[model samples]
Structure formats: C-alpha cells, structure tokens
Target chain A: MRQDIIEIRWHGRGGQGAITAAKVVANAVFKAGYKGVVMAPTFGTERRGAPVFTSLKISREKIYDLSPIETPDMVVVLDHTLLEEVDVTHGLKDGGQIILNTPKAIDTYDFGAHKLSISDVTSHALEAGLAPGIVNTGIIGAFAKATGLVSRDLLREAILNEFSVMKPEENARAAALTYDRTVIGGA
Target chain B: MHVIESGNVAAATGVKLARTQVIAAYPITPQTPLTEKLSEFVESGDLPAEYIPVESEHSAMAVCIASSTAGARSFTATSANGLLYMNEQLHWAAGARLPIVMCVANRGVGAPWTVWNDHQDTVSQRDLGWIQLYCADHQQIHDTVLKAFKLAETVSIPVMVCYDGYLLSHTYMPFDVPEQEKVDAFLPGFEPTHFLNPEKPRNFNTVTLPDVRPDLHGNTAPGYMEIRKTLHTDLRAALSEIEKIDGEFGEIFGRGGEPFLEPYCCDDADYVAFCMGSLSYQLRDVVDAMREEGIKVGVMGLKVYRPFPDAAVREALSAFKGVIVLEKALSYGNQGALYADVKSALYSAETRPFVHNYIVGLGGREIKTQHLYDALTESINKEAAVGDEPRWIGLKL
Candidate 1:
C-alpha cells in the first residue's frame, strides 16, 4: 500500500548478474539523488553455480536495517530454474510484479503475484551472440516496463555506467526489445 | 575526563577513542557489556564505524580479521567459549600480522560451563602468537587498549588486552578517558608499519626454506622474529614502550601511569602473593590485612603477561621468602603457565626462596579472600613442601 520507493529482490545463481542488478538499481537510484541500499545474502563459500539472492531497497530516506527483504514490491528472476527450486514469490506482496527472462508464456507456471510476465530474452541474447548471462539486461528492461520504479533513462544510465566495457548500444537495444514484449497485467 | 566505569566500559571507551573503523562481535557474559557499549556508540553515530552483528564468535573474529586486512582499524571482545570458538582465526590474525586489537574479558574455557573470571581463556591462546596484556584495573584496561593498537600496528602483530571476567570486566572504578583530539595527536592516521595494500601487492607469510626459517623466527628479524622469542622480547620491550607511550599520552591526553607492573608491600615484606587481572586488587587488600597481622605479605600484579617480565619477576620475587603464583588457568603438560615461567627466571638466582604455583578460579569459580588466605597459610606452614609443584584450590566435587 506504500506509494513511495519500491523494494525489489533478484534471484539467480551465484555467477549470474542478480547481485549486479541490485547494485545497478542502487547506483541508478543513488544517481537519481535518492537514498538506496543494495544487499546480497551470500553463503558458505559460494561457487560458480550456487544459488544466491540480492535485494534492493530504494527509499527517499536513509536505510538503516541490513536484513533480507521478506516482502518485496517487485521480483526479478535471472534464471527460470530458480522458480521451482526456490520460493521466488515468497515475499512478493499483492499487486507486486514478477519479471522473468524465459522464452515461454507467463501462463505455463502457477506463480503468486499481482502481475506475471515473461520475455524472449534468451533467444534475443543467443541471436545477438552475447553471453546467455545477458538475459539479466532483458529482465531488467522488462522490470522497468512492468513497474516504473525507475525511469528508462535512469536504467540506461545505470547499464552504461556498470557495463562500460561492453558496447552501450547492445545492452540498450536488449532493454528496448524486452520492454515491448513484457505483459503488464495479472496472468 | 574521568568517570566511574567498569573495566569492560573502560576498554570500550579506549576502542572508541582509538577510532577503530570496524567492530565485529557476538556477546558472551563478561564481554557483553563491552560490545553493548560499542553498539551504542555506533547507534548514536558517536563512533564512525561499522559494527557488524555476527551470529557467532568465530565469524565475529573472521570478520574482524578481514576488516583489519581491508585497511580498517578493527576490534572485537569475547570471553570463555567465545574465545575458544575463535581459536582458528586468532592464529590467522597473528600469522597474517594484522593489527587487530581484541579485548578478551577473561573467563574460564569450559565444558562444565562457568560465567566467572579466570585466565583459562587467554591461557589457551598463549601459543597463538598474539601479544597478550593483562590489566589489573579500569585505568590499566583503558591505557592497555590504547597501547595495544600502537604495539600491534608497530610490530605488525595482533594484541589481546585481557582483563578478568566479572571482576575487572564488571567491577566499577573511576578512570580517565583520554580526550579524542589528544589521542589523535598521539596515534595519528594509523600508517601501518606494514599492511595489505593492493597498489604494490606483496605476498605476506610466504613459505620459506629451512635455511631462511632460522632468520624468520624471533628476536632477530627487523619486524619478524622467532615466534616464542618475539613473544618474550616484544612483551619486555612493550614495558618500556608502555612507559614512554604513557608519558606521551599524559603530555597529550593528560593521563598516564606505570601501566605494566604494579608492586605493593614488596619493599620489606617476607612473602608476596603474585597475581594478575582484578584479583590483584583483592590480593592488595589481603596484603594490607595480612600486614596488619604481622604476616609481612606483599602483592605483585603482572599487568603484562606475554613478555613474561623475567627480569622484573626475578628482581621482585628473588628477595621474598614465599612467592605464591596464583593462577586461574592450568598448563596441560606442566604446572601453571605463568608460575613455571616465573620460577624458570629465578633458576639462576642465588638468593631466590620457595616458589609455589596455586591454580585457583578455574571454570569461572569465584576466588574469595578466604580461599586466597587459606592457600597462603597452607603454602607458608608447609615451608619447603610447597616447592615447585602446582597446588589446586577450591575444587568441590
């Protein structure tokens, strides 16, 4: 019911860009001159493919608590496999949104969320010759479309700043395509 | 400014003034107050530091060592089982030569779980290469902490400023908390004598051959020395540094003292009860009480433990007819640790008298004046019977 800054949770394998998404979100928010905190809960000598979560809280005021997010306004899944294995929707409040980077339709799985959506990011990533990990950028784009928590311009600025080594146009084009394919309403 | 505070609070105040950048701690009985005060400081923003709330003492020490290597002045306080749990990281902190300062509110390491004061916690860590300092009171507790940071950073060694649980850790006494500005002038920006900087990366603790290991170990190397010999030499040198630093500290912060060794009634006394930590305060009173009864009892408190002040011990105890080594911890293969060391120092002396090792207050057991008095009488009456062997006191099954 809060109409202020949105808190999002990212779910993915340790090597995936879930923590990067959270940090980018925080950097984007901080650049926008709002207070934000990005926290990642990593455990037990995490290896390349171990499950990990990164949480983000964007607020107008300073953030004090470092606890994991029990309830989130939005959830971004970098890997669809985590949905069945882990409770990705566990803390999503009513009217919250879920953005997935899978090629399938949103109705295929039973998920608890006010809005559910899937993007053709994997195919787009493979076709573009970018790594499979680039699906995170597509999901991030869909995140911006589903809930305007951050402006598209800010998201673009974050991606450019974070992925400075990569060609800026490649990530920006990926974000635009993801924004168009993402479904807005409940499944 | 001076205020009435417990020894635990005094150590916390020292940590605050020392401006420790990172503090990772989990609470244990006597050390709980120390971390609590630090938490309060972090909450009020009085100390601009990161206070990590760790789940266990092992993790607490791990985080502290990590933060210390990360170029942050780090600190933590723990007691008893907590210290034992952090045993692994304790060695790592020292071997890595990270200047991590820890306040070990000394309690008996246990399976029979006790919450009282003892030396067992620190006794277990004696071989871990940490420069350990024992404090007799609140003022010493404060001063020792300030000195620990300098000494640790100076020698690129970790230091544990230990005090008795419940006794000094909780007992209230007036102590002068040095002004932050003054302490800052004395101990500036912590330009570590050595550190882990990525700019010019150099591997620390690299493996060496038997040819070079002799030089690697002890009172020989510039900053590195043989582990055991360095522990001894650094501790002795620490006394002079303690005096010099305290003198500078007094000039800057307007507070100082003979922070290493405190002697009472030893000038003309025939017998002296040698102890450390807050128990020395009780022994001081006992010494006064016994003196009134014509016992000529003296008390010598070893404020610094690691540097086993051999010269100080021989000079102080050599003149006495009865020197009782009151220890709160036991040595597994031998007698009391400090007692054995003190006795060994007097081995070459011609005029040294009877030296008795008495192990009291294990598992946080309370060491009462009556218990101490009884132990003394037994030692005196037995004369030569109390020889070099250790005597265990107050173990009721």
Candidate 2:
C-alpha cells in the first residue's frame, strides 16, 4: 500500500525493537531515493512488555507536519499477541496492508480488509542467535520482500548500519532469511 | 554533502564545525545525545576541544563561564531542570558579556516528572538577557550554529540556539552539511576583546560602582549602570547585525534564515497565527490548508525570541484583523508568555489587532495540524476580551 505518501504503524511491546525497526526502515527508505522520511515512537517514556506503537512516514515529497500519523497505509506487528489486545487496524485505509510475525499459515488468519503478509521473523531471530522476544528488525526483511516498498540490499545495509547487536551478521542473515521465506496472501 | 541527521547530532555537528574550544556538559534526556556525540568527537580527535565531564548542570555552566573568562570559545548544552539549575550563572554569563553559545533542547518543566517537549524551560529564562534563536529544522540548527557564533562574538552577547525536544531532537531529515572550508570562510576565528592573564594582569570588572571609574592606567571606564545600559543597547543593536550576518551567511553558505522572524503568505492575510519552533512548521501547513478552505490564513514564525523582534511582529500582525498567538509553553496564572509579548508589542499600534493567546502541546502532548485549525477557528469565533486569561487548548474537563 506504499504510495506517494505512505504512513506505516508498527505494533510491538516495549523492548521489542519496534522503534529501532521504524528508524531503520525510514533510514533505508531514504537510502533508496525517497528523501523525506520520519519515524517516531509513542510518547510514553518507558515500560517493558507494555502495549506500545511506533509510526513512520516515507514520502517522495517533503513532509512538513511533525504530528504522529493518525491513519496508516500499512501496519507491522512485531508482537503477535497484540492482535487480540488492541485494534491494530484502527484508522487504516480501506485497502491497507498488514505484515505480521506469526507461525500460522497465510490461510489460517482472517485479516479483515487487509492484504496479509506473514513471516516467522521470530524463528529467523532464534536462528540468528537472538533471544526469544524482539523480532523487529528480522520482520523488516519480510516487509521489504512482501510489499516491495523497500530494497532488500538497503534493508540489509540499514540493519547492519543501525543494529549494534553482538553478531550483526546474524541480524543481516535473519533479515535475508525472513525476506525470502515470507508468504503473501489475500491481496 | 547532504546527510540525514537527527536534531541532537545536527547540533553536535555544528559545535564540531565551529571548532568550539571548551564543551562543558551534563547529560539530560533529549539533550544527552548531543553532548554524548560531542564526547565521542572529542575522544576520536575529530573535535579538538576540552570536553569537561561535569558533575551537575550547575557545574557545567560554571565551567563555560570560567573557560569564557579565560578567552576560550565555549559551548554547553542542557535541558529543563538543567537550564533551571543554571539560572544564576545564566545571568552571570550575560552580565559579564561572554559570547558563549548553548543549545537548549527545549523541554517541559517538571513538576509531576515528565521528559517531553515544550518551551516552558527556555521561555522561562527570557528575562536573563541572552540572545535566543529558535530553529524549525536540522538544517536551521546546523546553519544557525555557525551564524550564532559569529553573532555572539560580534555582539559579545551569549546566544541560546533552541529547538523543540524529542520532535526535532529525535526526528531525522536530510540536510546539506556545509563544507568545512566554506564554514571556516564563513565563520572566522574567535577574537576575545578582553581576558584574564597572569603576565599582563589587567583588572576586569572586580567591583564596578554605580558610576564611571578610572582604571590603573588612569583610563576612565563606565561602571555597573553603563554596563547594564550597554547590554540592552547592544542586544537591541544586534537586530540589524542579525539581518546582516544572516545575509552574509546566505551569500556564502547558500542558505540562511531571517534571524528575527519569517513571514509566510502574509501579504494579503486577514487572519494570521503567531508561533515559533517545530510547531511553526506544522502551523505553516495548517495555514495552507485553511487557505484552501478560503480562510485567508497566514503564519509568521518568530525565530528570534530574545531581543524580541517587536517591530517586525508589530508590522506582521498589523495587516491581520485577528492574530492568534499559539505557543507550546504556559505562564500558569497569567497568559502564555508569548501572548503577553505579542500583546505588548502591539499595544501602541494604530490599528491594534485582536490577539488571542492559547497554549497547546505542553509536556509534549500531541498537537496535530487539525488542532491549529481548531485554535484558529475558536479564536476567530470568540470575542476579544482585553484583560482575560489566555485559554488553554486541548485540556480535558
């Protein structure tokens, strides 16, 4: 659903790397020739494992407003449990898209009015030697492949440039694995 | 070269490019990243400056004052409580006329404890006699720092380059990073008019009486009265110098903002909004949207808050029948600080505009472009009460 001006909302708990993912994507989008990019986390100072969100806007035109995005073109869920906890598609456009981290196949989930993209980014993270939680960056690889909104090379570069993990190559590998393994449905 | 930078890093970059001599800093949210970047630069030898690791914000300001007294181009940055803590030194720096430049990542004043964006911190210190420059974006922050040093050094008045915390402080945008040689050509080396040295020990304002006094060399010098008079006079005089310096910078660097204020679509404006900082960017967009709706809306962004551009503001507001003063800071019992400033500036105008003051986005509360339209609509609909309290917008009753 990326267009001239696309607003993306990311759903994840605190410490799940939602904010970092948003920044990385925005930076990558900038690297991919779309100049105006903005990303911001929710205003709450800090609380781990709490329901939180981050929003990003990548545009071909110069963006003036600093206000947080109200309606999103795409929503990425870093935490799967957030599906039951909150209305993830609160102000989404009619033909908006949803990219999620889940084990269920493309046929199992009913994503109301959204073109669904599924990736087991968590498994990729585990393969990359990461902990059980926080599949934020890994999901971005699937995001790039499923939507074609961002470049794969730029996604890998963004993860490597931004993420300061123990084994950064692992983060890059996780992104690549998820990008190839992602399945699209109900477009 | 063009680079995508956050506000904090942009500021740090400015300090680095200006080649500040002494950077005394203490960490605080939003502003911590800026000082940390400076620390990294200092450690990496990219910025060859003495980076002081101070105990508190109080000590940080004290270090700047001490360094400035020793004739070093000094720089320091802090936020809300840190700025509040340096209140006494803030006066001392301005009173002593040290051309120290500091970046105040504008934040809300804490009472119940909040670390969000607002002008309460910087606006509260408007009385302390420092030239305050507010930036709308990272580009401005970068360019202004170069200009600020020149302005500060030329006028011998300290300057506070302020921007909204978290909003500009954390947000990213691509901006033209000026070449080092170009910056060097634009901003000259620091020249201290007077300093304390042991070998050539000249007494510098130990205890000036109310009137003029003679020095050891039998040269007559003005005392406290004249010193205070010169401070105000020089600040007022810098208005022209601000424009001149901005013009010169623009000519060389290819980008410079009007140091005092920027008027947007105000030529035929009947109703205008008065604002400053990042919110002004949003206000400009809101003005465009309202114009599409045929509201005749215009926006004038106040870039310089200190030595308040009274004449420019008066002229800008004179064309409009209604001028809504929107600010991120509040004055609690009284009206918003900026509203009072606007009211006073327009007090003597022949055609006094109806000025409505409102505070929004305090403590970094979300303010959308829609809120601007709402504020303007309500201000236009409501009657002008000359002596009433300024309304607080977006409060849940």
DockQ per candidate, 2 decimals: 0.01, 0.46
Clashing pairs in 1: B217-B225, B217-B226, B218-B225, B218-B226
lDDT of 1 at B39: 98
Q: For chain B alone, what TM-score does every candidate structure achieve against the true structure?
A: 0.89, 0.97
TM per candidate: 0.63, 0.93
TM-score of chain A of each: 0.87, 0.94
- How many residue pairs clash (N, CA or C atoms closer than 3 angstroms) in each of the candidate models, in the order given? 4, 0
Q: In candidate 2 chain B, where is summed lDDT lowest over 10 consecutive residues?
A: B382-391
State the fnat of candidate 1 relative to the true structure. 0.00
Provide all candidates' interface root-mean-square deviations. Answer: 21.2, 3.9
Best by DockQ: 2
DockQ of model 2 vs. true complex: 0.46
> Runs in model 1 with CA error above 4 Å?
A1-187, B206-239, B250-256, B383-386
What is the model-wide C-alpha lDDT for candidate 2? 0.86
